[model samples]
Target: MRSSGVRSASALPCKVPYRIDIADPPDDALDLLIELGALDIEQLAGGLAAILPDSVQPEAVALALRSASITVSPAQGRDNDSVWLLRTAPLRAGGILVVPPGVDAPEGSLRLADSEAFGTGHHPTTALCLEVLAEIIAEDHPSSVLDVGTGSGILALAALLLGVDKATGIDIEPAALEAAAANARLNHLGRRLRLILGGPEAVEGAWPLVVANVLTAPLIEMAPMLVRRLGHRGRLILSGISTTLEAEVRQAYRHVGVNCTASQTRDGWIVLLGQASW
Candidate 1:
């Protein structure tokens, strides 16, 4: 939670620093770190550790990373997890501005913008959703997608890129909506992407594909509403719960007549895919 020198806007795309310290490894340690945004594998020096940025000079950062020095290693091999890369084009949603990426938006394309909320295909929940979205597009090819609790609009944007006819995203945070709107514009998906601020209470409709990557308790509480918003044979993907809580989440969804058809786990986090029954 501390830094050495002042970092200008250009120096760090993220306003916040990306240093996470974990004392002891828990049963699901790595997953927890990923959830907290430790994407680049760094070294462990003494009991403290440093998670440097993806662009930080390894040798220099490694020395800085090691204070009292004991051990260290770069976090790597993240591709093993269920994840997909996305390419976004510049777009304008809600009349907000967006800038296109210097690099191409991945195969599936959509509007582009940035947000303050955590996700934009960088986190595990969003990553899992993208992979699942790709599979769904390949198989069922649903026409519409509803991303509930759409933090940073990554899920909904992925749907648009995958040829979804339309995508509607809803979130409770104003900042998140702003971010979603910005991302939509950045990807040039303003016409196909709609960003709304609020929860399920904010909108209603049956979408062929619905994804909610929120926490376990909230997901379970919103199960009824999510089920009601799915078209017949609609698919649902739920995540943000660790593997330890998979059974409980599955049971909760089952109680609401949602039968989980498949599941993917990364670093102990579970993403459950299900279908609406009745």
Candidate 2:
């Protein structure tokens, strides 16, 4: 997340640029650009397109974003507001609709606030995780869930809305936990959603189901701990892994006695479902 009010510390040009391009931006990308006075913004395929004031150079804004690991490329263009004018439509994760906070949403749709944390439902992994989560919940009716690396708490929140009794969201980043907490409240799931500002070790309890949508490496490293925290007949959903690395991640869990019973792939990303092989 951008500091509340940080004076420009990086080298940036003085003239404001008209257009900005961001590739693989974080969840807070849109919020940050909007905060940076972007005239308008649109989601791109694994990127972002933002219209900024042409009066200033793109250097400052670009530098500011790079500090947060988001690259902002200068893409000057003639006024084309019409290009992104019709994107207010909501996105879907399973049967749940994803809309920005305060936007008109059908009942039960997620009204996610703009956040710097991840899991804004823009990524394919997040949507895939939700699709699998919905299916698992529908089939098993698990009462509670543990969401590891719960960025915006979208997964845990969705679990509650999908009929799970309670959810605990864990994230190593404090900012992520904060974002998740706020989102839980936004959807009135705060009371049912517990936010933990640390890794899985911060909490101790076996869960009927656990969902972790973090990247491949962390998932591999945390395989044992996560599997150990599952109750009898527990189910695990692991995502954020690329198709190329699917075998490596699956092997890591299988090494700890997990039998991945199902898997799905989308846009080259993969999600896996596993159970303890007793």
Candidate 3:
């Protein structure tokens, strides 16, 4: 499950929407905005810009970016509708059709919302994970799945739609769990999906299929816990790692006796498939 950002200040009766414009933002500054839950980010000649919700304070965001030496300025307020101008496009991954809510999906397609929880199916990491999941399911059906950092619960929900009997999604953020639950209901898979509000420790039993789409540091840090949650002969699909960190992540899991069986890379992001030898 993905982590949540800091809660915003209490909402006022009326609020003005704003965009935070960063001048000459470095890669680290841009990453900071993403981690802080900036919904829409755009590249600019000067630096970068992000559209934040009305609830978020531009000053607060600027303060945070100060450490990275990025200068943030707030643009004039705009209509809320402009925030979602870039609608999420439908993604066809393997046998799954991931569409945003209210959009028409083909029969058997999975409908998800573009919520704050992440994993809308458009990201390279999520797409790579989906592709890996589809391949594995086609080769051998898995009875159950455990989705770690289940942002938007897309990975776990997709598994159920692809014939997995049941799935459990774990995340450290309540908002993510809420979004995942809503998506499960949207896809009409609520009964077969269980949402948890914690990390790997929140999961009690091992699963035949486990997928975690998280960054390299967290993935490496949770290697032992993740391996423990994988049933014997089970398959583990890990993503949200860059090509440069592939070796480091592989070694981390190898230390726990799991070997990378396959890997797929797209747009510099890589996903690894692993299995433990009994």
C-alpha root-mean-square deviation, each candidate: 10.8, 11.0, 11.3
Error in Å for residue 218 of model 1: 0.7
Model 2 backbone overlap count = 7
Reference-based lDDT, each prediction: 0.65, 0.78, 0.80
Ranking by TM-score: 2, 3, 1
Q: Model 3 TM-score?
A: 0.71
Off by over 4 Å in 1: 1-100, 104-114
Rate residue 208 of model 3 by lDDT.
Answer: 89
The numbered model that scores best in TM-score is: 2
lDDT of 3 at 89: 65
- Over all chains combined, what TM-score does candidate 2 have? 0.72
TM values, all candidates: 0.66, 0.72, 0.71
lDDT at 79, model 1: 22
Per-model clash counts, in order, read 27, 7, 4
Model 3 agreement with the true structure over 126-152: per-residue lDDT tens digits: 889999999998887999999999978
Worst-scoring 10-residue span by lDDT in model 2: 77-86
Q: Which stretches of candidate 3 lie over 4 Å from their true place?
A: 1-85
